[model samples]
Structure formats: structure tokens, C-alpha cells
Target: MSNPKGKTYIVEHLDPELGQWSELEYVAIAKETQVAQGTFLLSSLPEAFNVPPALSQVPAFKPERRGVEELYANDKSRVCLLDPSASSDLGPDDGDKFDAFLFGGILGDDPPRDRTSELRKKGFEGRRLGPKQMTTDTAVRVTRMVVEDKIPLDEISYLDFPELKFNDHESTQMPFRYVKGQDGKPMMPEGMIQLIEKDADKSIDDLF
Candidate 1:
């Protein structure tokens, strides 16, 4: 597909365990083209973009409680987008309006969750977590980006994922960038870019 009109913002959820490096999940395409020029539902982009639903929501193979755990533990993180024409819910001529890409990542145990209190008490406000903790932060960041039209770094609190023994003494911060596509191009909307850059600069100044 042709690139969208705005700057691309790539958001990744890195899993330190399983040797899975950073995976590109969500790509917010530019908003100027005829295909992306509307208030589309977050659920509608798979068809227009010729991508897959798996691109948005990764499926679980097992039905039991640990099915989720087993899936991720196996390191099968790829998702497939099915043909919309085959769905009874969608018509063949439907243009893939919301087929814009969406993605994320999962953090493995590293810095250790139990040590979070130590970090927080030591003036480390953002660091450490369980799966729920990390997911919550991710959801909040994505929502803020969509609603406020900008990415707020401060909104993201850090959690101690496991770190290498040699790098144990290093400090980790939550790093963020505009979402990008598989082609290494940004998929951010035009208006979103201005807001992200503006808010990011403000956040940096506040830190000082």
C-alpha cells in the first residue's frame, strides 16, 4: 500500500525473554489519502489495507487459562490477516478503510517485579511489573496517543524487565518513537506528528 501522509510513529512491545527482539505491531498510516480520510472505526482497517486481523489482535492457540502463556512462551508472535471478502459480515466491494496497522509488545522478567518497591522508594517512579502491569501501561499510552493526539512519555511508567547480569547497574528508561511499518516507514497521522513532537519537547523540558 502507498504510504500515508503524516509522519510515522512506531510503537513496539519488546519481549526480552524468548530471544524475541522488538516486534513492530502498530503502524498509524498517514491520513491525507482518500483511503484514510475519514473517522473510521478502530475495527475496520484490515480490508482496505490488505492486512490481517492478527496484525491488530494476536490470537491464542489454546482455550485454557495457560493457553495464552503457552502461545507466547512458544514464541509464535506472528499474525495473519484473513480476506475480508470471505466474511459474511463484509461485502466484497468494501474498501479497507481501517486497514491501518496496529501492533504492540510484551516484556519478560528481567529487572524483577518484587524489586519494584525498592526502585520506587529510591525515587524511581517508573519501573518494574507483571504482565498486567505492562499491558495496562501500554493501553494507556495508546489511548492517550489516540485521544490527546500525541504521545506522552511521562504517561509511561517504567517497569524492571529482566536485565543482563553485566548490565545490572545500568538505568533503563521507557523509550518511544512514532509507529513505523514493515518497510521501516512511519505510519503516523499528519496532525498526530505535530502534537507528539510538541508534547515530547514539553516533557523533556519538564524533566530538567
Candidate 2:
């Protein structure tokens, strides 16, 4: 797939703190050149804040004392918000309809906090991926397949709530949707298993 002409994928970083989770996802999101020029991070950070070297693939924009609304105010109609609560699913034809696609960069909450509503209320055209909540990385990949590869939503394969096993005795389940690969595995961001194991081990420590 080639780059979508003049389309930039925007992630409005809503999380208060930068963590391993967002960093890995942003890196994965940056790999799809056909769907985006770059993973543009929009956030309010201190004047001295610098994007981590790992995220060099993503371009960071200062808040400029402007909120997401003000920053995109002029192009509101040209932006598409990926909102889970949206009534419609994004499709291949949307490639030429919008200049940019905006996604919330908040870490997902189980049962979903619907944090995207913050962006949704901005009144950009909204589209849904499916009924399941997906990690930011998966969402970007799916969107790329849909818009740039001209794949229909139903034509895409998916793995839901995949389980991660640390050992024969223990495992944890991710309460999210993921893209399924031809090898029959969930397409996950690199280092995600380590992160999952780290969280799983911490849960054990909490019980002590």
C-alpha cells in the first residue's frame, strides 16, 4: 500500500503520563507509512519535555496553549475521530474523504472508560472498529487495513481477549480485541509480553 495522499494520522495524547504502553504502541503505529505520514503526537507537555528517543519515529507537537479543539478547529470537518461509541464502521472509501484521522491516545480501561468521548464531543465524524475495545496500536493497524488497503471491516481477521501465560501455573487475559495474523496469533506490539508479565508479577506481589 502506498501513502494516502495528504492524510496524516493524529493521536491526541490524553494520558497524563508517558509510559511503556503508549511508547510501544506509537512506535507500531508509525510503521504504516501507507496509511499515515507519521504518528503525530498532540499533547500538552512542559517546555523542556522531549520525545523519548524510542519514539523518534513520531513527531511531537507542543500544546501551544491550545487544546485539541483549538488545534483542529479549522479542520474539524476534515478530521475523523475513531470513537468506539460511533454508529458507523470505518471503510475503504474513507481514504479520500478526510485529510486526517484522529485517535485518542488514552490507555484503554477495562469495560472501557469511553475516554474517546472527550474527542468524540469535538464533533468530528465518528467511526467504530467493532463492538470490542482495541488497544491504540491495534486500532491504528486496523484503520490502515481498512482505509489504505481497501479491506472491509468484516474481511479482517481478529483475535479477541487473548490469554498470556507466564508458566503452566499462571496466565492473564487481555480484555481487548486484536488483529489476528495468518499464523493464528494476535498481532501485538513488541515488548507487550514483557509488559504483561511485569503486570502479572506485580499482581502476585500485591497479594503478598
Candidate 3:
């Protein structure tokens, strides 16, 4: 039972805007990840943007206006990027070796537009969770399962493209892979199902 307080987890926000989905994921990340020394930092922000008050507890930096190079400056070699296209799997032993883990703050597209390549192109050591795309929070939790809990990637189970049954006629299919909980259910963040239903209803409204 080791706490992941020793490592710093950063979400490099590349999304055009922070929406409810990203917000829910970040809330989960803030609750689960115990970063080292300071709070969770969402970097590469725009000058005009403000992190909602709910996430005010976490640090959001506009690197253009406020330099944030210090995050990985202390030791860049110890940092790893969770890239889906990476060559190797993130191992359990990697937890003690790395000080910082970087995750992309973009929505996982159904076909995967490779948005992480924005940071991947920057040349940080890259590691993969698997071949499939996972939601940002799922990626973070899976990374913690390896790094913090010392679990191997293959030992973990997953559910892919699970459809959320909003009602008898309305259901939404998630396009990302998710870690299967012991209950044999996709381990989704709180408020996700409701969000799915809301989005599903909105889509229906758009059809009218």
C-alpha cells in the first residue's frame, strides 16, 4: 500500500478548451494523484484562460506568461511521457526511477488523432499503456497502477468500447479503453455516466 506522493503528475493541456469531460477527469486526478511538494500543475495554458474555481486548488500555469520549465528542469531524464504510440510498456519498476509523469490533456478521439504527439515531438522518454487509446483519467490511473502499486501492465484487465445504456432507446458507446474494476465494470470517474447521458440527450436535441 504505497502512496504516490513522491512523484509529480502534470497534465499538459493541449485541448482547445476545458470542458466538463476534462473537468471531471481532472477532478479525479486531483483526488487520486498525490504529487510531490506542490499541487497538480496544468501547463501550457493560454493567457486569457482561467482554471475554474473548482480546480483552483490545483496550479494552472500559462507558460508563455509564466515560465514553467522548472517542472521538468530539475531532471528531464527522470520524466516520462505516457504516449500511446510508444515502443515499450510502462513497467512497475519505473515508479521509483522517475520523478515526473506527463499526460496529455486532450479528449481521446474515436480514431485517435495522435494529439499527444504535440508533447511526444518534444523528445521526452515515451512509454505506452497499450496499443489502444484510453481516456486521460484512465491513462493516469493505469499509470499509477504500474508506478505506485507495482502492478505489471499485463496483469491488469480492461474493457473496450463499453456502451453506456442511458435508457431503453438511448445509449452512448465510449470510444476508449478502460481498466476493468474487480466488479467487472469499467472503472469510470464519478459523474461520467451522467455526463454521457447529458451529451446523448443533447445530440438527440440537435437532431430535432
Tell me, by TM-score, which candidate is best.
3
TM-score of each model, in listed order: 0.18, 0.83, 0.83
Local accuracy of candidate 2 as per-residue lDDT tens digits, 186-208: 99878877877877756421211
Which RMSD does model 3 reach against the true structure?
4.5
C-alpha lDDT (0 to 100) for residue 116 of candidate 3: 73
Off by over 4 Å in 3: 1-4, 34-39, 58-70, 201-208
Error of 2 at 94 (Å): 1.1
Poorly placed runs, candidate 1 (over 4 Å): 1-39, 42-183, 204-208
Residue 155's lDDT in candidate 3:
87
List all candidate RMSDs to the true structure.
19.2, 4.2, 4.5
Which prediction has more favorable TM-score, 1 or 2?
Answer: 2
CA lDDT of each prediction against the hidden true structure: 0.26, 0.70, 0.71
lDDT of 3: 0.71
Residue 154 in model 2: lDDT: 93
lDDT of 2 at 72: 70
